[model samples]
Target: MPDRDPLIRVTAMPADTNPYGGVFGGWLMSQMALGAGSLASRVGKGKAVVVSATDFAFPGAMAVGDELSVYCEIAATGTTSLTITAEGIARERNGEATVKVAQGTFKFVLLDENDRPREVAL
Candidate 1:
C-alpha cells in the first residue's frame, strides 16, 4: 500500500472483468482518469477536461473482488492545463498482497462555465 491516501478506491466487480475474466484495462484507465480529473478540478477550482492521456502501461493484473486504489498527483501545471500522473494499485481479494497494476499521465485543461479553456486559479 502507498503511504499517501488514494484519490479513488473501489472493488473490482465481476462486471468489470474482460472476456478472459481478468479486470479490464479500460476499466482501470477510466478509474485513473476519474482520479486525475478530480485532482485537476480541485486544484484548478473549476471544471477540467482531459486533453491528452499517454504513457499507459499495465504492469500487473487484478481479478474480480480485488480492491483497486487510484492515486493521482499533479506532475506539472501550465497556464490552463494540469499534467497529472495516476497509478492504480490492486490488493488481493482475501490477502495482503498488493501490486502496481496500471499507470499513466493525463493532461487536463481547466474550463470555465461556458466549457471553454480558462487559466488555472493557481
Candidate 2:
C-alpha cells in the first residue's frame, strides 16, 4: 500500500486459516519465500536456494477471505547470493488496508547445474 510494486497476490482460504479463522504464519512465510526466490532466480538467471530469513515481523492478522499481496525487491547481491526484502499486505474485501501482515528479508544463493553456488548473473 506504500506504492511499491506488488510481487504476488493470493486469497486467504479456510484451509489456510487457524482455529481462530486467521491465516497461519507458516502459510504467509511460504508465500514470502516463493516471492523472494522468484526474484532471486530472475536476477541470478538460474535456480536459487533460501539460505536465511534475516528478519521477519507480523504487524497484523490475516483473516479468511482477506486478499493478500506480497511485494519483493532485491536488497543486495553477493558473488553467488542475494538478499531480498518482502512485504505482505492484507486487505479485506470491503474494507481498507489495515496491516502489513508480514515482512522480512530473505537470502538466497544462486545454484549451478550441479546445485553448487555460482556467480550471480546479475
Candidate 3:
C-alpha cells in the first residue's frame, strides 16, 4: 500500500470488464489519467492539460468486483510543466491481497486563463 493516500479509488464493475470477463486495461489507464489530471490541476493551481503520456506498463491483472486505487506524484517540475507518475493497484474484493496493476508517466502543461502555457510557479 502507498504511504500517501490514493488520488482516486474505485471499485471494478461488470461494465469495466473486457470481453474475456477480466478487468479492462483501458479502463484502468483512464482511471489513472483522471487521478493524474486531478493532481496536475491542484499542483498547477489552475488549468492543466496533458501534453504527453508515456512508459505505460501493465504488470498484473485484476477482476471485476476488485477495488482499484490510483496513486500519483509529481516526479518533476519544469518552467511550464509538471511530470506526474501514476500507479494503479488492485485489491481483492473480499480480501486484503493487493497487486500493482499498471504504471505510466504523464506530462502536463500549466495553462493560463487564455489557455496558453504558463510558467509553473512552484
User: What lDDT is reached at residue 73 by model 1?
Assistant: 93
lDDT (Cα, tens digit) per residue for candidate 2, span 14-115? 999777777999899999998888888888888999999968898889888898889999898888889999999998877886588999999999888999
lDDT, candidates in the order shown = 0.96, 0.87, 0.95
Worst 10 residues of 1 by lDDT: 113-122
- Number of backbone clashes in candidate 2: 0
Instruction: Let me know the TM-score candidate 2 reaches against the reference structure.
Output: 0.92
Model 1 steric clash total: 0
| Clash total of candidate 3 | 0
As a TM-score, model 3 comes out at: 0.96
**Per-residue lDDT of 1-122 in model 3, one digit per residue for the tens?**
77789999999999999999988989998999999999999989999998999999999999989999999999999999999999999999999999999999999999999999999997
lDDT score, residue 22, model 3? Answer: 86
Could you tell me how far off, in angstroms, the CA of residue 95 lies in candidate 1 after the best superposition?
Answer: 1.4
- How close is every model to the real structure, measured as TM-score? 0.98, 0.92, 0.96
- Candidate 1 residue-wise lDDT, 15-42, digit = tens: 9999999999999999999999999988
Worst 10 residues of 3 by lDDT: 1-10
lDDT of 1: 0.96
